[model samples]
Target: MIEAVRVSGLTKTYPARRGSAHVVAAKDVSFSLAEGESLGLVGESGSGKTTVARMLVGLAHPDSGTIVINGRTRERKDHGRSARLRRAKEVQMVFQDPYGSLDRRLSVETALRDVLRWHMPDPAKGTVRARIAELMDYVGLSEKHLGSRPHQLSGGQRQRVAIAKALAVDPAVLVLDEAVSALDVSVQAQILTLLNRIRAETGVSLVFVTHDLAVVGEVTGEILVMYKGEAVEHGATAEVLRRPRHPYTDMLLSSAPGPDWHPERVSELRAAFAGTR
Candidate 1:
């Protein structure tokens, strides 16, 4: 299978503030995604997964790394507006807050049409409308809702619109940084199911960055477990969840709420693992 995304030796650090040492967000992180494959980037709050996602979508520039998508190696710095727009077509990110990502003033139809026009440029008059309808349908939204703005929609509906807008560009890679974490449990399930169907139909590679292991299990086939800005484990999702090799991975899995979950044990593990890392 062809590779859709490849990241090598990615490292990013923030300068020290207030006389403290510099902060390292990701250190020598490397991973690959085949065409149509989904990989979960799982970690706690400060594990650098979000940093990696930001870099993948060109939102953050890495101190050192190489990122290649769909046979194109991205330049270290995007040179101009044209280059940035080209990168937008290669990789799109769906942020955690749907409301923050979208414009409250624009209707859903207008938002999608704008993206298509920007990336695709001067499609036939009826083509844009048809494409907008297709994108809305892909995200389980109907034509009636096209006139609604972000404030008029529920959290889940807004997120679906966000996904549709991201898909409008026909990006080779979709980076979802905690995309479903803000919704209710039932809503999260629906969004996850929608993502799986979208992947199946479009064959777009996915980098699902999330803290919830259960969430990743629904959408990804492989997993990369990160801890304290480092990749501690990488393997098949089922194997890693069932039989995690790293202590941090074990702690993460055990920390999940389940019939067998033990908070005391998780605390102990966290304390024990802190020294090892």
Candidate 2:
């Protein structure tokens, strides 16, 4: 399979702050994303999943690693206005809070128009409108909804708009950092279904970062489980979920809600696991 994104020996460490020791956000994490493939990066809070997503989209710099997006190696010199815009074109990130990512003052149409105008060469009124219409269609929104602002839309609608904005640039990779975690279960399912359809239609690679194993199982083919900033297990999503190798992976799987879920069992396992780590 052709690689659309690759990260090798990825590591990042935040400096020590007042009365706090330095934190190693990620360490020697390496993974490759096949063209049009979805990879799930799963772990609990502080497992470095979000850090990886940030690094992939150039939001956070890696201390030591190479990130090749769309076959272009990201370098330290990839700074400044032009390179930043170029990077944005290669990869776009959909944040957890849909409202936070969008402009409250701008209508959905205006928000999408700004992105298309900034990214597209033509930027013509007619062309921009056509593209905005196309984007709304892609995200399952109607023309009437385009005139609504972020506050006017529901949680799911706002998320759809966010997804549309990310796709406006026609990015090679889309990093979803807890993108659907903020929605209700029904809304979550809708967003996941929408994501699956979008992936099928666009052929864009996806790096789905979330702590929920169940969520990843629905949308991702491959899974990478992280523990304490290290990848403890990586393989086909079904296989890993069926027969998790690492202890941390097993703990995570057992904690997920299921027919036989036991909250007390989860607590015991978590406590036991914490002692080992």
Best by TM-score: 1
**lDDT per residue as tens, model 1, 151-269:** 99999999999999999988999999999999999999999999998888898999999999999889999999998789999999999998999999999998999998989999999
Q: List TM-scores for all candidates, in order.
A: 0.98, 0.97
Clashes of each: 0, 0
Q: Residue 270 lDDT in model 1?
A: 92
In model 2, pairs of residues that clash are none
Q: Which ten residues in a row have the lowest lDDT in candidate 2?
A: 116-125
Q: Write the per-residue lDDT of candidate 2 for residues 179-200, one digit (tens) a residue.
A: 9998999999999999999888
Worst 10 residues of 1 by lDDT: 116-125
Q: How far is candidate 2 from the true structure (C-alpha RMSD, Å)?
A: 1.2
